[model samples]
Target: MSANANTTTLWRPTGPVELDLVRALDRRAWPPRLPDQPIFYPVLNEDYAIRIARDWNVKHSGAGFVTRFEVDTAFLARYPVRQVGGETILELWVPAQELDEFNAHIVGRIEVVHEFR
Candidate 1:
C-alpha cells in the first residue's frame, strides 16, 4: 500500500508475540502476501535493498499465501532482514473478508490470539 521504507508497525510484538516469538527464527518462508511485481525494501544488514515478489509462492502452496513451508540453506535467501527475526511475518494474499478467519488461525501461536481476534 505504501513504500517499504516506513518502520511503522503492522502488528506489534506483545506478550508471547512480543517476547520470544519475535526473535527466535532461524529461517522463515511466507507465501505471496504482497503484489506479484518486484519492490525494494531496506534490510538490517544492507543499506541499498533487495528485490522481493508480492506473491512469490503461488506454485508450491497453490494459494496466494505465505507459510512456514521449510527451512534449508536455500530458504535463508528468501527474506530480507526486515522480515526476519522470529515468527517471520508473512501474508496469504486474500480478500478483505478472510482477514478475520485467517487472523484466528494465527492467533493459535500467540498469547493474545483471543484478544487479537
Candidate 2:
C-alpha cells in the first residue's frame, strides 16, 4: 500500500522460521515473540534491514528476508528511534507485549522486498 503522511514505512529482517509465522498470519501481523525475545525491533531503513538479512540472518538461519510494511505514524510515536550503530542504523524497539497493538496499526500486508540464502 502507498504510504501517506499518517503512516511510516518500516522494514524487518527475518529468518525463515519467523517469516513462515508471518505468512501463517496472512502477512498482516508478526507472530508473538519467543520467551527469550522481549523486544520487536523494526529497522527504519531498507539498507539496514538488508544488511541484517544478508549478513546476520542468512549466516544464522541459512536464509533471510526483508519485509516492508506501513504503520500508523501516531501509534509509532510512543517509541523513540534507536540508533544501534552508524547513523543509518536506526530501529524502533517495540516491547514484545505491545506487538498485537502494533500489528493493529499496520496499514497493509507485509511484503517481502529482499531475500538471501
Candidate 3:
C-alpha cells in the first residue's frame, strides 16, 4: 500500500512477493492527496480491497476461491486524472498464493470478489 509522500513513511515490504504485490496495487494508485490525511484515500482503497480479500481468504483460503479486483474502469476513464501520469493512489491485495504469479504478469485479474459455491 502507499501513503502521502509527506505523511507516509513510504514503508514497503521487500521481496519478490512484496514487490509484485506493490506493483499490482500501483495500477490503481490515487493521484490526488486528501487535504488533511496522508493515507485518506490510498489507505481506504487498500483497506477496502484487503477487507474483502481477507474475508474471501479466510472463507475459502483452502478452497482456492480468492479472486482479483481493480479500480472501476469507468471511474478511471471518466476521470483520467485519478491516475495522474500513471501514478497510483490505490493499493492492491491478493492471496499469498497468487503473489508469485503476479510478479511476471501485472496485467491480469487482480482480485476475485468471491468464488462461486
Candidate 4:
C-alpha cells in the first residue's frame, strides 16, 4: 500500500483504563481525562501498547486493553511526537471538557484490539 500521511492510525491507551471507559471508547466515544490526568495519551505502536499492558497496567489494575481507531491524520499532524524513554508516544493535549470534539475527529469505530487480565 502507498504511504498515506492521512490514513487511519492505531492507538493504544497510555495506561490501564476502567472497563467502563473501555466500553465508551468501543463506541467511538473518547472519554475525558480523569481528575489527575491533564493530558490524553495514546501511543502509536502495538509494541508500546503491549509493554504498557504487560508491564504497567497489569501491575496496577490487573487488566489492560488496546484500542484501534482512526483519527484524522491531518489533525494529528499538527501535534508534536513526545518521546518518553525511547517510546514515541502521541499526546493529545485535550482537556476533560473537549472529549466530544476529540471523538468527532475519529473515523469509523474504536475497537478493542486486545485485553489483558
C-alpha lDDT values of all predictions: 0.26, 0.96, 0.32, 0.66
Candidate 2 at 110: error in angstroms? 0.3
lDDT of 1 by residue, 1-117 (tens): 212222211222122222232235322211222354243222222111111111332232322211121122232244434544334444223343443333333321221111211
Candidate 1 local distance difference test against the native? 0.26
lDDT of 2: 0.96
Runs in model 4 with CA error above 4 Å? 1-5, 14-17, 87-98
Candidate 4 local Cα displacement, residue 101, angstroms: 2.0
Which of 3 and 4 is the better model by TM-score? 4
Ranking, lDDT, top scorer first = 2, 4, 3, 1
- lDDT by residue (tens digit), candidate 4, 1-117: 113456557666534455567575566766776788676766677777777877777778888777677787776665567767674554445556666676788877777778877
Candidate 1: the clashing residue pairs are 13-18, 14-18, 30-66, 31-65, 31-66, 32-55, 35-54, 65-92
- Candidate of highest lDDT: 2
Instruction: Using TM-score, give the best candidate's number.
Output: 2
What's the TM-score of every candidate structure? 0.18, 0.97, 0.22, 0.78
Q: Which pairs in model 2 have colliding backbones? A: none
Better model by TM-score, 2 or 3? 2
Superposition error at 27 for model 2 (Å) = 0.3
Count of clashing pairs, candidate 2: 0
Q: How far is candidate 3 from the true structure (C-alpha RMSD, Å)?
A: 15.1
Per-residue lDDT over 1-117 for candidate 2, one digit per residue giving the tens place of the 0 to 100 score: 347889999999999999999999999999999999999999999999999999999999999999999999999999999999999999999999999999999988999999999
| lDDT for each residue of candidate 3 in 11-112, tens digit (9 for 90 to 100) | 111223322444466632212222442331222243343443445434554222223333333222321223322344444333344333423332333333
